[model samples]
Target: MTTSFETLYQNLQAAVDDELQTLLCHHQPRLLWESMAYSVLGGGKRLRPLLCLLACEAVSGKWQPALPAAQAVELIHAYSLIHDDLPALDNDDWRRGKPANHKEYGEDIAILAGDALQTLAFQLLSDPAIRRPDVQVRWVAELAGAAGPMGMCAGQVLDLHAADSVWKEAEILDVYRRKTGALIRAAVRMGALAGGAGPEQLQALTGYAEDLGLAFQIVDDLLDLTGSFEALGKTPGKDLMQDKKTYPALLGQAEARQKVESCLLRARDVLFSVPLLQTGHLLQIAEKLVHRET
Candidate 1:
């Protein structure tokens, strides 16, 4: 029997592929479209969209209604990765076993592609297909807050600054909360709201998402220490070389693993308290995140 996470992952990938292909079908400058497709279609786990779909289902909302929003989340995620891999940023040469966007495409095209994807996210959200105008507006606002200077961008800035300084664990946690946790938390909350969750349920699910996000980052840090480039689909040990603070760097490998476990436990506990049936899939996602090889 297929596990719930496996099934959900397949479904999420299908949805993402469909949405992305539709976006790519439009006639545009070939170079721009190809660059956009390269960054977006480069294999990814599609975790953000999965969270959106599951969160919607958890609230008894139809998953179809949340598809646009899910696609929006994914676009935003792809845009972030494209920018993150830029020479000015992480300077990564590989993503999902392929050359990073800027490495394959010119740096200018890659930057433009990232910008286009970011704008497309909002365009997707604003489409009439997504029901509830108020919900869509709120979702856009939330996503903006998470992706902008006050959130992930700010976290990246802090990371760059911390490259030359000794950062405490708390400071590192703050950076991850913004860089990684913000989008993740937004994905969950947006899913819940799209599914028409009550305020209380949303609150509980947010807690679950937040814990899971932290655990995900902790595991990512651990993987960087031990995983091979082939298994990781990106450069490992980059964080250490960059002098960026990570959970493993601050807490030691064993302690970092323990922290991931603790966070996953807390996420599961939060799920248990919620009445949403989709919590089963959320728990599975949390497990997969910690155990993922790539």
Candidate 2:
């Protein structure tokens, strides 16, 4: 029987979680590990890691070989969230329905935890167990590029600047591309590369990832406005409170939802255009992201 998307997601999430738990258990210094694990093991969608695994499977690569990369992306994602919630950034008091790392563990510990997780991601990528050195090298570069100055960090910088001024549509989109979409695109590409996908297939996945990323941000904007604290696991209406530039701020709620639908359709088109072995899970993921209540 074909595995359902929910089943596949649950299995992959468990696998990634186990890997993180094992890694943390072996690390020295109990408090540091505890802080890192607190943010990592906390409730999350695990979307980046899941996308990595699914992309690997879609490219006919054994997903097991890509597990390290998947884990690495999640680590980077978790670290980003930790830092993003700091007072210097978004100043969020809660995440995933729990106290923010900074609030729960104090600002200093939270900063260190984020830094440690970021470095650990690179460590995971460098592990010799992940198959070919060439693939490993590519994975390292892909992930670093996505998470560093050229991608997510740059987006954060843009976000900081935007707080002081009104942003154009293009500028907001650029922030979305780098801040949210870059790592997601890298997750898909890294998985495909690990699976030995060709240039054409990689390009298709890139397009699909980019659209999905935009849809994700748009949905996020919608949720911040329309969702509740119970559903989002974080404070609602934060965007408006912070005066952050968002799709809903620029396009309005109905228009933002419409935009998400459009982006999802385009993403689906790109995903189906490629000759993937199994794309149902990816399609479902895209749909869930676009229409998610939280």
Candidate 3:
């Protein structure tokens, strides 16, 4: 019998957790490690890492080799959240239902923790353990491209600019594509590359990531509008409070959900064409992304 998606996800999450623990186990400076451990270990869906592992398994038929890449992407995500929550940015006081990293650890430690996780992600990727030197370098570039100026950071700048400003749909979507979609796109491509995917397969996976990423962000906007803090592990209504650009703000709740459904269909179509035995997990995830309460 085929394993269920939930079971597969639980197993993958466990592996990623183990890998993260091993990577940070022996680090020096108790405060830094403490902050790192607190932020990194803080619980969430692990969606990005799971995407990497699933894409790897879909192409290569195993998730083990992709663990390092999965861990790297997750660390980048954690670091981003840390920095995003600081007084300089979103100024959120809670995450995963606990005090935000900056609130609990102080701004200096929070900043250093984010920096450490970002650098450590590269350090982990550069290790010979995951892939060959050439392949490792390629993976690093992929991640950097997604997380750096042209990708997530660019989106963040646009978001900041959008505050107290009227935004066009194109502008909002551009932010979505760069900020959230970039890293997700990297996750899929990194997995495919690690699994020896050719150009055609890579292109297909990229298309899937694009749709999935947009849908994911749209749902996030919806959640911020409709979901409870307990469910989201962060403040709700912040988008409206800050006048942030978002799908629901521009498209309305009903239209935003419709857009997510359309994206989900596109994602499902691309993912199903890949001819992987493990495609169900992705399809199910797409469904969840559109339908999830949080």
TM-score, candidate 1, is 0.96
Tens digits of per-residue lDDT for model 2 on 1-294?
A: 145767877898899999888887846777788899999998799899888988888898467767889999999999999999999999899999999999988999999999999999999898887558999999999999999999999999999888788778899999999999999999999989888888888999899899999989888988898889999999999999988999889989888888888998998898878688877878888887777777
TM-score of each: 0.96, 0.96, 0.96
Displacement of residue 114 (Cα, Å) in model 3 is 0.3
The runs of at least 3 residues in candidate 1 whose Cα sits more than 4 Å from the true structure, single-residue gaps closed, are 1-5
Candidate with top lDDT is 2
Better of 1 and 2 by lDDT: 2
Colliding residue pairs in candidate 2: none
Better of 2 and 3 by lDDT: 2
Candidate 2 worst ten-residue window by lDDT: 1-10
lDDT of 3 by residue, 165-219 (tens): 7888888999999999999999988888777787777888899999999999999
Model 2 residue runs over 4 Å out of place are: 1-3
In order, what lDDT does every prediction score? Answer: 0.86, 0.89, 0.88
